[model samples]
Target: MPVSKPLRKALQHTADECIDCGKCMTYCRFLAESGSPLSIALTALSADENVDALSHRTYDCSACGLCSAVCPVNAEPDNIFTELRYHAQANGIFKLDQYAPLLNYERLGQRFPFKGESLPEGCTTVFFPGCTLPAMFPDATRIAFKILKRNNPKTGLVLNCCSKPSKMLGLKSKYEESLSALVHTLERKGIKKILTACPNCHVTFKQFNTRLEIVSIYEELKKSSFLPVTPSVKEVTVHDPCVTRSEDSIHKAVRELLKAMGVRVLEMKHNKSNTLCCGEGGGTNMHNNAYARNWSRKRINEAQRTGVPMATYCAGCVNFLGSDYPTAHILDLLLVKRKSIPKPVAFPFNYLNRLIFRFTAL
Candidate 1:
């Protein structure tokens, strides 16, 4: 159900173009440590290989687009990973049990119904909060709603799955079905502009089509001063999302926002354009939680060196990190909370990095 001529063509093109320069493997925290080109290439060629824990490997991708960024032939390992994900899903091998919290996501979308609370009144902008944020981090969604109301005033949220989780885990039919539902919801609402908090969903939407103005919340924040800056957060480290920052300038806005909040920010050695994956993207956690945990731990330790709280704009990153250290989402940090939980973002980027490197390097 997932394969098509265009999809096949794109996949093979990327596969054929690979120079096997090993440059991608160099920075590939995945291949650099546990992976091999032969295995990765096989996984890409066809999803038939046992791949033994291939699901875990797929989920661990972080979908950071880094491989594509470093490729000499522009083979785009990220794209290969994306296609393989769909194949994995089609084979019923890549289900996200870790995202159980978001199981209510689809129900919530249908129950809440983006019918009444949507924008343009017959125009095109829709507020799409991916499954993770609304279900796991309600506060961010609350803040998102508050800001959307304050800024656009007329715009309303379009509740739906965005198909990111489904797509990432390789569920082709489900992904398309979810995407169709989204398109129908928007069309029914007469909405055009799509504003999303999750970067992965934003990218999925763009991949399907670019007819609408897909804007990120961080991007919207840059245009207007809706939320007040927090002077208390004098020092903090920012974590970038692998799937989100491929070619976007939003991470810069995040740094700017942090500066505005009075947070003296320190950059990660792999920050911005070369940002590291939280190890949870690319559906890796669903494939291999332990490996995902190790990758996340590595990142957490990196932030710990700054001797400051770790901050990220992504809810998934926030949830993954919040399990261990004093990790907080930028939205939660920015929002003045009456009662707060000072938990840190937990998951490590890699076990090796966590064990081998110390914070002094940061």
Candidate 2:
């Protein structure tokens, strides 16, 4: 596989900037275990003989950006690995079979993409509950919509995929097409503000569609007078989704909401900006399931050390962490009055939930 000149230059630039401080490796389980940080791996890739070994290392990364986040020199290994994925895909060095299930899921989303229920006249804000939220917690989705509608009669609902899965899969052109269509739809409908439930969707809208104002549902709920009855559980550890690590406001807002519901928030050792990935990040589970599970195990262990149940806002995070820990979504605390933690939906049910949302909610 021949690397393009641009990619080679990018990799070389990252290699040159790396100081081998080992800060990134401390945050990266894959790099720590493999003993190959960007400093060493990218440098090795500069030689053609090391491409195969380096490529395998690149795929091993979850691209969760933990390394980049802790990099003192601003050498973004995650970005470099992303470019490497593109390079591998272009040169036909990477196999797509492992990614077929995720690809097919994205394809289904594209095929039956959700449309927003129209807003009343002069309304500009709509609730863009991302795909997973509706699928995993249908009742929560409905409750969120009802609250939004109650707060503002013109509040609308938009159910659609944000195409993060496609982006993570290194299908740049496909992701752009999906994103462009979404932006066009919002613009066409005169939507100026989006209240997003999923952190992935919130970040995607902020990155790709800057023309619109993106606010988390947590933030919106904070301002509104809507408060559901509190659940039986009082104290739980929070697992912030890795994608929105930089967004302190979302993190604060989630905690505030939990506090309002009279739930005592137990802080994990890794919280806010320093949070770990939920193992499902960057589509790593598709290609490197073992590596992904290692991350999840580490996070679950940390939560267990706190001696409290784990709670997260992202449906994806809840699903991933719930397999190992007594994980619950914040919505469960707010919307449900149950005494026990909700069970994570099983394999086929997870897929079926998405389909159910596509047909019924959309």
Best candidate, lDDT: 2
- In angstroms, how far off is 113's CA in candidate 1? 8.2
- Per-residue lDDT of 271-309 in model 1, one digit per residue for the tens? 666777787776567556776776777788788888887
Could you tell me the TM-score of candidate 2?
0.91
Which sections of candidate 2 miss by over 4 Å? 1-9, 33-45, 48-53, 113-117, 351-362
- For each candidate, the alpha-carbon lDDT, in order, equals 0.64, 0.79
Can you give the TM-score per candidate against the true fold? 0.78, 0.91
Q: Give the C-alpha miss distance for residue 80 in model 2, angstroms.
A: 0.5
The lDDT of model 2 is 0.79
Alpha-carbon deviation at 40 in model 2, angstroms = 4.2
Error of 2 at 156 (Å): 1.6
Residues 15-61, model 2: lDDT tens digits: 77778888877777778877645555565565765664565567777
